[model samples]
Every structure is written in structure tokens, then in C-alpha cells.
Target: MIGQVVLNSNIMSVNLGLGVVLVVQDGVAKVSGLIGVRSGELVKFKKCGVDGIVIGLLKDSVSVTILGSDREVQQGELVERLYEVVKVPVGYELLGRVVDGIGNQADNKELPIELMEKALVEVKAPGVITRQPVREPLATGILALDSIVPVGRGQRQLIIGDRQTGKTVVALDTIINQRTNQRPVICVYVAIGQKRSTVSQIAARLKQEGAAPYTIIVAATASESAALQYLAPYTATAIAE
Candidate 1:
């Protein structure tokens, strides 16, 4: 009934309930049915099977690759997905262990279900789904701090030293390092001190590393409510997760 358009080649297709959509364009009519639909995308309104080929998905349309050449399609034809009205990631568990903001488990429990279909997938800690060996070095720039600190992939390492020991710098470096890895980790910097220069430096560094897309920053200083500061990291983590 409703799904995101994922592809449109000889056949138009979408991520249906648990499968892909297949719409035959040329076989029935040919008004440039498959003018859009490439990889890494979503489509809505239409539905079909995972393996079946369809004809068109003007919505969220990207030029589908054919035998040899590629072409452009009307982006307007594709529709962006509206957020769902589903309840929170409850009927779930999130305790003890540090978990992302979403209801997804951060501890060692296995998921009970599988997402066999593709719809409007949300940012669930972004890369928590992709596992890469935690071997690539993530530099901290500060010699003393760098030497003493270590963070594993998907780790929940907290910075608990005294004031002015460069905790922010440590966070900044990890954000920058993500640019060099094949599967980079996402960083959500939550600054409680309300330092302007520090946040500015972070923005500049993110541009340098080309990792801005994967990083999120939250700043709340002395005057703001303690409640806000306490909740900042969790909020950012939830969005990223």
C-alpha cells in the first residue's frame, strides 16, 4: 500500500512490506516510467515485490542504471517519506548499559526481528550497524591526553578528568578521525561548558576532515538548566543512533 521507491530499471521497484516492488513500465505503457530510482534511496505511495521488476517510480526518481549508460530523472517525481506515527522504541529494553537515544539495544542482547525490507530507515547510531575492526588509530592531537586515552569502537568512554585537561580536544579529534576510515564512527559532541571557541574549533576541524555529515554537536553552558546539560549527550546520542 505504501513504500519507498528504491529502483526503477527495466522494471520499477520499491521496498515493500518485506520485499521489493516490481512495476513493468514498457510492457504496459511507456511514459518514461523508470525515469528515476537508483541505489541507496527510498520511494513512497507505490508497492511491489522484492525480486519483481517494475516500470516506473517518478517519485524520488534517480536515473536507474541500464545495460551501459546512465541518465537523469526528475527528482520531484520522488517523494520524501514522512516520519511514522509508531510508538517509541519501547516494548523494548534500555538500561544499565549506555545505549543510543533510539530504543535500539546497546547491550549484548540480539534483536528479535529483522528488517528484510527497506523503508525510510532512521539514523540508528548511523554506523552501529556496520562493524569494522577497532584497529584504525583515532588521534587526539594532545600528546599527554592522546597517550593516556583509548576508545574502542561503539564504546561509551566518558571523559572524567579535572577542568582544562582538554576533554573537548579529545572529543574533537575522534570526530576528525572518522574521515579516514572505510567505515567511520559517528560522533555527537555534547559540550556542557558552553565554550564558544571550542565549538568553533570543532566546526572548523569537521570541515577539514570532511566528517561533518557524520558528526553532531550540542552546546549548553553555565546558565542553562542543569537538566538540559545532563540530558544533552543522551539526546544527541539518541538522534545519531
Candidate 2:
């Protein structure tokens, strides 16, 4: 289904490039007639205000990953390049809250505090000269993990396993362990393609264990669009940094 395109008066003042949806395929839409759009730029479908991000530059069109309900978009619908990059909300106020990939509250409560600080979702890493060596240990408090595989403050560890495996358990334990650690590290748990109930349970567990004060949950449930799931990790990382 396609919604009627509505052009508000502010659109002209914003100098947004206008385009038309040429094709819609599996969470992606091909848009034509847009100019000056780079990969990762945010765009909005004029029809229903559904957000999308430019993922690829085609010969004559741009491939945009639709971030919201894709069912509201259709071929020939109007699109407007927002002329802005995707950003996520950042601040201490985000602690203990469940947010979506875009940093909007997912717990169904009205966020009374205004989130004034925002950061771009994508950033370039610092050069070697600006980097610092990892000297501190990030203890997970799990005897099995601490003895078998110790993780440091700046190390990257990948926990992989089949379905029903204890991958999430390992991550949750590490997060919960931070509650009593000497140097507490803020934790941001990103849930991608997970059931809503599973995300809720994790949040509840964190709160019950007294770790929610220093943790944030970014959830893109299984029911959400693929675009959101793709953005979840980056969003969580931005919040963590």
C-alpha cells in the first residue's frame, strides 16, 4: 500500500532533494532523482514519513534501506533526502531505558527528559598515535571464562554458537559482573532479530541484578524491519562510547 505524498511548507526551506521510488524490494527501495546523497544519509518517504538510509549508489538510483514499516512505501512514491546523517541520542539520561535502534523509548513511557546530546552513528577510528594501549582487565567474574579466556578492557571478543547455546548468557554475565567491579564499564546490549519477550526479560534481569543503572538496551526485535536490525549494533556502540 502507498500513502499519499504530503509536501509540507518547510520542505522547500530545508532544501531537501526530491526523488521518486523506482522500485521496492525486500526492505530496500530504489530511488531516483535525488542529488548529493551519500551512503548512510537519512531519507524520508514523503508518503508516510518512513525513514530510510542510503546503502548503495546505483548508476541512476540510490538504494535505501527502509527503517520503518516497509509496507507503507510503494513504487512511484515521493522521497526526500534529509541532507543529514543518521544520529543516535547519547547522554547519561539513557541509562536504564529500553530504546529502539533510533534511540526512541521502547518501553512505552513518555520520555520526560530531553536528550540534547546526539552523536553520528558512523565515525572514523583514531589513528595509532592517538590510540592507547590496553592495560586494564575487564573481568567477567565467570570463573570458567576468567580462567579459560580472559578479556581485557580494549579487546574484542566474539561469542558465537548455535541457537539455544549460551551466547547471550555469557554477555549478560559479563554485564552483570560490572556492578561490583572496581572500574565499572557502561554496558550497552544490542538485541537484533530477538523476540520482544527475550529483550524484556534481559532488561528485567539487569534491573533485578542492580546493573541497569549503568546499562542501556537497544532492541530491534524479530518483528522489526531488517533495516533496524542492521542499525542496532551501531546505535548501541554510539551509546556506549
lDDT of 2 by residue, 98-204 (tens): 99988888996666446468898888866877777878778898997888888988778999999889899989999999989765789989999989999999999
Please report, as a residue range, the 10-residue window in candidate 2 with the lowest summed lDDT.
Answer: 1-10
lDDT of 1 by residue, 1-241 (tens): 1233342422332332221222323212112233333342333322211111222345533222211111122222332222231111321122212222222332344643243221222244446557655664455445664577755554556777897896766677767766667866666665665755655666667767787666655555444434344445555455445
Q: What does the lDDT read for residue 215 in candidate 1?
A: 62
Error of 2 at 184 (Å): 2.7
Q: On a 0 to 1 TM-score scale, where does candidate 2 land against the true structure?
A: 0.87
Could you estimate the TM-score for every candidate? 0.38, 0.87
CA lDDT of each prediction against the hidden true structure: 0.41, 0.84
Count: clashes, candidate 1: 25
